[model samples]
Target: MTVDPSLSEEIIARAQSYPGIRAGIARLKDVLKAPSYQVVPEGEWSTSLSVLQESTVPEWPPEARSVLVLGLHHPKNDPRLDWWDRGNTNGNRRLMEISESLKQWLRKELHLGAYPLPYHVEWGGLFLKDAAVLAGLGIIGKSNLLLHPEWGPQIRLRSILIEGDLQPNEPIEGFFPCETCDVLCHKVCPQNAFSSGAYRRPSCIAQIDSNVANKVPGGEIDENGNSILVIKYCRACELACPAGK
Candidate 1:
């Protein structure tokens, strides 16, 4: 059975219509085999938290054959995108809304199941970086973030599982933006997270932990119209990268 390319294209168009969001399609099997998905994160610099129960995991629906990976560009130095207020950031909430909108659109128009998975894999979500790469979005750059052709590593990734198998896009070939550069991402890191090819997650987390401890106040306005403290996570390495500038 030949899959209609327009179906995938239409789905992507619907997703990208929303500001700062881009979408691409990948095969579910390909996403599952991608690097991050296969890595257990059991090493000394492990980033994975305690895994949730199988019941809580967002397992692929039987009819779900195509993966739609959405990336919301969180541009460099865009403080509004990363500002955490209460339990969510503005960028994050916007992406969540987009996911819901797509899910509803699929159900109402196509009469299909569109499972919008969580952003975190530990909580029943897919490894978004892997999914994005498989979806023909961009490559995993030297700093280990998915560097898009346009948005670079500044893009925040999310994925949705569509009901029918759709045509997958070919991965970009012969593109290596990281190779020609001086690799400023590692050098700019305060904690030296990317000291070498291996990013020291422990050091990175330590910086984040310190940022949380010394939360900066008055960044976010609370529901009661009060100014609340906010933790501005370190993005020095992310910002230093010339990509998406």
Candidate 2:
């Protein structure tokens, strides 16, 4: 389906009018130290998109024109951001707040219908790193996290899909940050999660699903199976990066 012809101009104008939209985006950059940020291209992350449509959540509008993808830095100093508090409440909470706030502002200011997506595969959340790369925000490192030029692999992400179509943003051109840097992320894994290059995409997905299964009502289970103490933050890769230090 084609985007509404006027959707681009309208959304851009609306985004300009609200200092909040700009501020919100800027706040993300400030907090995350993200070097690159942009909206996702239409049809990007189709797998997750299909999951959302089939979910219990309502269907996306026919003209669901664009997505606003935001990134937050998860620096090594603040490893807690990536720690898995049982059920991943803290990380997910931060994602939800940014997503919901952006949507609320867009709805009120632009009359746009916005949806804040959940952050789980079962809940129809897509692979965030894939979305971030497609959105031109960053490249996915060998460590399996999205790495920005300024932030390395220390970033988290959330997004809002809007009903009206907007002009899609350009994809950032770049390659892996690990290309030149020594593979510090792989070396630092306590569990040696990256030891043998054992993470096929399908296996990775299964692992995440299985890890979260039977989690305490509000807890997270990392690959190591230590429970309830902390839910869902893992950052061996992010911590190892030398960028933005």
Candidate 3:
């Protein structure tokens, strides 16, 4: 069957219909080959887990030809969005709900398969930053975050692997904020993750470890009626960046 010329737009329309959401399409192949693709280490933990979850991938399905990447407007004022209640942050749970809703819509209305992806590349999921870039959502900035045209780096992303081979959105051009803006994102990092003009993952991870070890006062009753401490991860770099707003 010949591809529908307007399918991409239609899919995007459906995706963006959700409040505070924006959508873009990308070719699955391109997303796999995008830069920083190989950074996911073949470490013992990741490899072992990937092997265990190999059946979940199922060869990425031949019909899974495109990716539908969605970005949610996470304004700085909405501190709740980034607040962690347990293992999942409020924003992440919201993203998962939106992804599931979109999947249902595509299945019922478009007769399409939508595979919601895990956030981690270590899992059976794609590189979301690369996927976002290919989907025309934004560019990776000096802070190493996806900088959206309007939202700046203040957006949270989620993606679904779609069976529809929708047309890909062209990558953004002529948008550069890190070029001239004061690099306060680097300065704001308490861990100095960008001190040397490069993201030091170890330092960032250490800061995150510290945060986790020092869990704060916010947590909720667990499924078994037990209280759990909440650990809010560091986002000093993202909060300091003035890209979108």
Candidate 4:
């Protein structure tokens, strides 16, 4: 079936209609050439229980023409959104639900093929921060987080691959939030991830490893009144940033 030429607007509008969601589009070809794709993915124990595993590569669909990137703001007040439990975070689960709903809507109403991508780059997922930036959602700040205009670096991202072509959003220009700042985000890191003037991914991963070692009980309780232990990942750099406050 031929795709609706005006489907991009509808898709973005429908996605943003959900509370606290911000959406944008990027051409699959452009996203393939994104900076993140140029580098090799690291094999580490950041979230997955496996330690020092081989990097997982995604098998991109040959016919996919565009990507719809979604970002859900993670406020500091609601830290649970970023906590990991049973291998997933509440924020990521929320994004998955939203992506699934939008994918079904496109397939059923518009006769378009859409599939939600996974969250982990090791699990066949796109580098979401790269996709989000290409989709005009935000800029990658010094802390190595996507800095949205309104949410700064406090947003979680996900994406969907679409068989039909959609117009890519223009990336944000001249919006470097860290350019004039004192880099407080860097100073706040427990692992000194930015000590070398560039983000040391290994250092950051070490903190995540620590968070896993010191897991906390989640708010929800099971039928036995025993709550699952959730990993509260470190976000000192993200919280120290004054940008979206």
Highest TM-score against the true fold, candidate: 4
**Which lDDT tens digits does candidate 3 get at residues 1-245?**
46675988998998898888888999998998887785653213222443222224435677888999999888888766876564566787788888889889989998999898876675667888889999999999888999998998888888889995788899999989899888988999998888889888778877887886787756467678877777777878888888874
Error of 3 at 116 (Å): 0.9
TM-score of each: 0.89, 0.63, 0.87, 0.90
**What tens digits encode model 2's per-residue C-alpha lDDT throughout 29-115?**
222223322433222121343422323344545555456666666555565666545334444456666666667777897687887
In model 4, the worst 10-residue window by lDDT is 48-57
TM-score of 3: 0.87
Which pairs, if any, clash in model 3?
152-244
Model 4: how far residue 97 lies from native, Å: 0.6
**203 in model 4: Cα distance from truth in Å?**
0.8
Model 4 C-alpha lDDT per residue in residues 56-134, reported as the tens digit of each score: 4367677778999999999989999998776677898798889889989998998888878876766778888889999
Which lDDT value does model 2 have at 59? 52
lDDT scores for all predictions?
0.80, 0.54, 0.81, 0.85
Candidate 3 residue spans exceeding 4 A from truth: 40-59, 219-228
Error of 3 at 53 (Å): 15
